[model samples]
Target: MGNAGRNAVVLVVTKVADATADLVIEQLNARRIPIVRLDPGDFPTSVAVNAYLGNHGLSGSLRTPSRIADLRGIRSVYWRRPSPYSVADDMRPQDAHWCADQARYGLGGLLGALPDAHYVNHPWRNRDAEHKPAQLAVAARCGLDVPPTLVTNDAERARWFARECGPVVYKPVRNTDYHGDDSRALTVWVEEVAPSEIDTEVGRTAHLFQQRVDKVADIRLTAVGDQLFAVRIDGAPGLDWRRDYDALSYTLIETPPEVAKAVRAYLDAFGLVFGAFDFGLDRHGRWWMYECNPNGQWAWFPDPITERITAALADRLQSPGNAHAR
Candidate 1:
């Protein structure tokens, strides 16, 4: 290995108590890789960064309580789930906003500009793949089977689609947490809807209505680099498999070659090295793509799947050139 490769470090961006990050970091540690794990939520306070333009390119140091990471020496960055930056409560609202912007564009921007550093999946690319409509379109374009989807804000159109499509499902454009009357947080679950349920209120905002696929099982495919780990999830009949994790049973299975090819193609289209794809496996043995989460959760999965994913990620971080080769 060259000097740069010898001195390279792996930067992990994630919040505390993230089991997924913990596993990956554990693997990296076993491989004797230098790592700097920092949560940006403590930025401008506990976490400090100083970057400057130099002859080599963007160079900086990220300082936390225990250690400091040399920005220039970062070969691969695992952009896992990091909490949002928090500002001082005593600061004015406007001042806090300004400070947050600086932290984002300044420190965040410098990290984004690192030379030859591979981000597992770039943050901007992650944001782009998060769009359900865009993901459907891309999956379809990649020759993956996708269910008919309609995004509209017109009640008449929604009703027409619902009537034409035998069984349609209503899903939020983006899942969000809402407080109930009792101040308890609740998440909106995907539910099958009828034509009669279409109301004028749907016209108030854009909504997603898709023809529900007659699926016997759900598939969760976690892609790390070019490798895809598929798990067949069998559970109670429901519009959303995520409604109850406890009710689900998982089995590791090989992904069909054609579908796997489409998955790799979809990742290329999104410029992502990693993605978590959900699919509906129909009773007729057809697989239909739903969406891909660029920064999705994978640790809770069972058996060899989680272990395989953790190793794949650690390998990618340990050898980033393989990611580009894929």
Candidate 2:
């Protein structure tokens, strides 16, 4: 383990108890690669940063109780999910706000600028790819079949669009979990809708409506670097399979050649090396693109798929160039 390059560390920025990250870190440990696990939420108290511009280049180090990472020596970063920054509650409101701002722009900016570091999916790219409209447009351009979609805030427009598209479905433009006034978490599910069902309230905010595909099964294609895992999800029947996770089953499958090509092109368009794509396999055997999650979760998947993904990510992190596998 000592022979592993100390100058090249894989910086994993995710919160504690992230099972997926924990698995990947363990794999890296087995490979004897240096890793620095960080949770940005612990910035002031547990995480320390000392970054600056020097003669050689951007120079600094991040120090935690367990490990220290030289900013310049960071070979890659697994920018996994992390909690938001925080400040002490005892501080005055204004001072707390000011300190949080400094931490965000100061520490966040420097970390974001790590020299020659490879990001699983760069933060900026992840933000850009998260937009559904952008994703659909790019998928269509890549020769992928996307359902007729409309995003609008006008009730009349939505009604007319639904009428033209036939059996259309409404989905949240963003997957945001809400809480009801009763202090209970609320989840929105995709549901088929008719033109008459769209009310005037649709004009209040933007909504996404797409023609529902007559899908026989759902496919989740998780792309890690150059490796693509195609899993056919069955058992649950409805507008949204996600609503009934316990009822779902998974099977490892291969993506059609054309779909595989388009997946690569779609990722290339967004400058992303990782993306979780959803496709509906129509009864006619055609796959229709639903959406892509740039930072989507895939660890819940069972067995060999999880192990394969962990190995792929660890291999990518260990590679010096931080370039895409393919």
Candidate 3:
């Protein structure tokens, strides 16, 4: 709390057990910067927010166990993943549903409108950038190479596109919570799809099919403010490197000039200050755009790289003026 009386506070919005947020918080703590970390989902239970609109605008105080954050005095906000708002299960289902919606729009709206506080990535922008179709379109427009892709709910169209694209892969446009019959969590991994394998079941919902690149490796480039950290991930024996963490190797690498420029443009197009971009490095040394995760995780990488990213984020949170606001 050194000089905290003179310094503006940073509000970290995330769940209690977030390792990524923990890293940044540790860095800020070492700097003696004041931070109020709270999950909005804890409202009415462990957290409280009081806001009022007056002559100046919306201003209030958010109270947690050990700290209280002044809405107007917050210099920056690190909006990470927060748990969903919940109420007691003993209440009627209909009443609980209504209460949850109210809390979402009420407390959620207040957090989204923190009056001049810099957001690592504003939640609204994150929502807009999360769509895979929009991401591919923007990346291509920014001069980045994009594979031939098709999103369809028609069985014939899917098969036709798959045949035309030669080697195609099927992946979920966005990962959503899914559970098996036993109530265990399930993941839909990216896999090669043959035209014949696709059937009327594909028509049940929209599916994304992309021309699979003859990739030799994968690149995960994390951007913080104006800084970019590119890491080459090798030895992943499957289409998605995320499927196996222990089998992968990481090497810090320099970003290609063209790819770097296009990435910056893509970020600007979506008004995002931070993004984690995934690219496929083909045998020809070409980088193909996969997707850009606005609120993606980055703290899992090896030593020096993770340290650098954490420091950059801490720096951005400390100096809100250095971040661009849409």
**Top lDDT prediction, candidate number:** 3
Worst 10 residues of 2 by lDDT: 1-10
The C-alpha lDDT values of all candidates are 0.87, 0.87, 0.90
The alpha-carbon lDDT assigned to residue 249 of candidate 3 equals: 95
Per residue, candidate 1 scores C-alpha lDDT tens digits across 191-294 of 88999999999978889999999999999999987788999999856878787889999999999999989999999999999999989999999999888889
RMSD of each: 1.6, 2.3, 2.0
Q: What ranking emerges by lDDT with the best candidate at the front?
A: 3, 2, 1
TM-scores for every candidate against the unseen true structure: 0.96, 0.94, 0.96
180-244 in candidate 3: lDDT tens per residue? 99999999999999999999998888899999999999999999877899999999998999998
Q: List pairs with backbone clashes in candidate 3.
A: none
Between candidates 2 and 3, the one scoring higher on TM-score is: 3
TM-score of 3: 0.96
